[model samples]
Target: MTSYNKVNGKWTAENDYLLNEVLKKKWGFKGFVVSDWGAAHSTAGSAQAGLDLEMPFGEYYNDSLINKALQTGEIKEELIDDKIRRLLRVRFEAGMFGPQEKQTEGIFHSNLHKQIAYEAAVNGIVLLKNESELLPIDTGKVRKIAVIGPNAAFARIGGGGSSKVTPHYSVSPMEGLKNKLGNSVEISYALGAIIKNDVRIIENSFFENYNGKKGLKAQYFGNINCEGEPSYTRTDTEVNYLWYYDAPYWDFHGADDSNYFSVRWTGKIKAPKSGKYKFQVMHNDGARLTINGNVLINLWKDRRKSEIDEAVIYLEKGQVYDIQLDYYNNGGVSEIKLGWEIPDTDLIKEATELAKKSDLAILCIGLSDHFEGEGRDREFLILENQDKLIKEVVKANSNTIVVIISGTPPILETWVDEVPAIVQAWFAGQEGGNAIADILLGNRNPSGKLPCTFYKSQNDSPGFSDYQNDDLQSKYVEGIYVGYRYLDKHKIEARFPFGHGLSYSKFVYGKPQYALNENNKAEVKFTLTNTGISAGAEVAQLYIKPLNSQVERPEKELKAYKKVYLRSGESKEVIFELNQDDFKYYDTNIHDWQIDKSQFQLLIGSSSQDIRQTTTPKSL
Candidate 1:
């Protein structure tokens, strides 16, 4: 009912193509439909195509089109009544129709949704590698534990964006373990390096000796925004307010390079334990770590790299010295990292002697403000420091199991070899901490899988920048191939592969059954059985690939997926509809979604690469 930009005379009063056949025959999505802001051009056609509610509100939606559509008999008069009733039903069902109790933050603390989120987080964690049977820390074997790293103190609950959420609580791995172990373990923390820095932090108090020209720790300073010419203000304050962004900005890209964040911060570290102690630290933009003030590993500098920096510091029994680092970023994005590997061998040896004590070294890592802060174009040609955290921790302490908390998948190649387990804790709202804790304590079986592809290297991606301008316009140059589709289509392997997940328990799949109906849509049914000792959930993925195509297409696309929970030794049938849309593709030349009646291959599997059987669809 509302009209914004008619987009020249080329855009008709209605785009009937998408409404009648596509929404009906393809998506079968006839419900109380909502008109996207300014999407309503002709009320008669849109209503006939099933337009229900014209939102949000505008002059075009008022009376003229409504009366015209009714007078012309273009839309059933009863359709309006049905739509209103359906909207009311949904509103009441959501508990948003009237007032009852004032909703508070962390209101879902004890909600089943939170439990589901926690379970999803644990399942999303991918156990890339487990060498020497080094995991399952057996916290009872180590007495003295060293928890080091930026993440040890402040956990990254989510990135910065619409997906970003202020959780009711976020449980740092440090806090989670403390809750898990209680009084039996002794833990210490070390912040080996500062987060990204700039000249802004230098003007603040703590930096009397910590300027960018540093003597105390590592330091680097530059403009906050790296894009255009920076605005200068000599009368304001320090060297540059030109750098870093003011708070409350939005980043749909990766991170913004404009704004004053932290200054290059480097800290001289001290180890509390004498035995084998562990240290973990990660930074975006620029970072360098030195033990006894020597370069252990340096992965910093801002060149659009979004990998997480990490390291395991080995200490000489109770040997305490300075750990220094230097860093700065031109705003764009932010990242926070820190974790502990494990106690030194001698410490482990000593701990074993001390009443059989052992502590878990859980390195929780993910995207940070610097890596995913505020900007519209956050895509990077290089994965940043957060990408390195898991490798660093696993290399330092075989006992380390990293838990990644973010809204989306971060590239996972460099560190997969070192980690025995991974959990995708997608910004779990306010109860982040409690949810994370619940998963690590084995209270929940991870049942989540990759929602998107995790490229092994930036080189493997098709469009990782150098595409799209600032006009809020970007093309699907890859055509219908997105996510797993592109990976399989191009035969480019990913770090963890799509639809891959692991649980404490195991599952087995039986042959799949293909059932045809008179309509083009069909159903594929398969049996899943839990064969492990513990109850768990398994996510099954269905991939559809054109046997041969009139035009080039992705090797396979994710058509349907389902997650089934089964107790130990339980089995259930998982059925999914193979609708006509499953066989559809966006033809750029035609500017429409098309489906070929040619042969299609349906591969049902545990992961994208683990197809157990293949089937074909019946054409209408």
Candidate 2:
């Protein structure tokens, strides 16, 4: 019932929400929400709901789906009217369409958002483990620095979503840090692990069992050659190969005809900066890399007969080196986690050392190539090693700061309390390194909240294993209750609740004023004032549940929410409108959305379960 994002080209689009909610409701949002992948099918209207433009998807506006929606009455023409009007409102608010500020043509493009992204990254970086003051590597003092690790250079950048923009350009951590340190800090590098697991396989199946269902929309490119040749190609058939692409118009036509093909290639990667480093690597299939133009990765490039097992390398500071690897997947599944450890920044090694000099230790641990950014969701292989690493790191160094960078939530229990601080750096785009550095140096206070929940373990989930492929037969097990709702109803506790995050600053919540008109529906107004030194946005969440109902119910569900930014001592009345629809849920028994006409409880809080204020409905 909620929405999920996807990646297409350079931007992220809302495959689910943007069209159904933003466009369907013609929502007049003052602040624009971003899109996640292939969502241009409904982009214009999305922009109307305060989503001015889709990120990285360039400036494309899908007219076909809009025309279809309008022609079939799937959407009303009035929606277009509202959309244009709402976009104008955003334009005015941004001083683009309004008389407030006459903008010069050149001013249309701004880099301020890039800075904002960096700052946001700094704030979101959760300090998971820090012992022996192993951080704040004063750039001025560190003479020889070794930045090693598959992720040290690899940019987990913004993930695959409609927001995924074919960036006009992008920056990786190694490049950014090298630019930051200059020649003062000598650095070494080693891709001790592989970031992307090359999956190659030769297998196909005929769906004689496939019922008459719409197959994958076909868009054939008919095999373009590497040197501009029309090489071998395959035609179409009912193979159900749902080839995913981000291009606006898939202009390929063909019938399913099987064909054979072969491809090859190679490249090199140099340790842009050199210091002291070592490798820790893994892989299920083939791959190759080179240092000093020597193959760091040496594997047979072919089918499933052999896999690129693993490789290691030592790093030296300020020494320019080269790297090259060859990879190809034959079939089935594959896995890889290639990381490096530089003597200067090796948390794992430092944590285990007996002669550590720093007063506090900061262990920067989280989803490396496994979580966040792209290749594939859940492709980052978040396994039991995560739990083990957390516990071991904290046990080795008590005063540790832990940071997690994942697109989704991971279980937490092994070392939550053993560590002093935790930060959630959710795939912050480019300049990720600077963001981490700034946060560690106290340049910013974190204000980002959990967009999803963190469970204590997978077993705590009712149906984690059967969720992906078991569609019709899949059972919610927990019923209508999800996330905080299910936990609250069953009195089950989560490692971290949704919308939970810590800030260096503090805030206060005033009692909410619930009011209604004769129609027995209205919005509740509340005042949220930030009493901290730094400015930040607060995501005020609204949850509702039936007081007395004839049907079964979960705990409270998030009905509506609003994010507001305010300065210290500045106060604004925040309002949340509650309508009949707000109280309704999909009543499958009646096959319609319905709202129970009875007493209701409203829970307002910094996050789910931790209610700071509550109220009983005065009406409806």
- Per-candidate TM equals 0.58, 0.58
Best-performing candidate as measured by TM-score: 1
The per-prediction CA RMSD against the true structure, in angstroms, equals 12.9, 14.2
* lDDT per residue as tens, model 2, 444-472: 54556776667777766655645666443
Superposed Cα deviation of residue 549, candidate 2 (Å):
1.9
Error of 2 at 26 (Å): 16
- What are the runs in model 1 whose C-alpha is more than 4 Å off? 1-128, 131-136, 140-145, 162-164, 197-360, 380-395, 465-475, 517-521, 585-595, 616-620
Off by over 4 Å in 2: 1-113, 116-153, 158-347, 368-397, 465-472, 517-521
For candidate 1, the lDDT comes to 0.56
> 389-478, model 1: which lDDT tens digit per residue?
334444555566566655566666666765665566665543455556556556665666766666777666667542655863445466
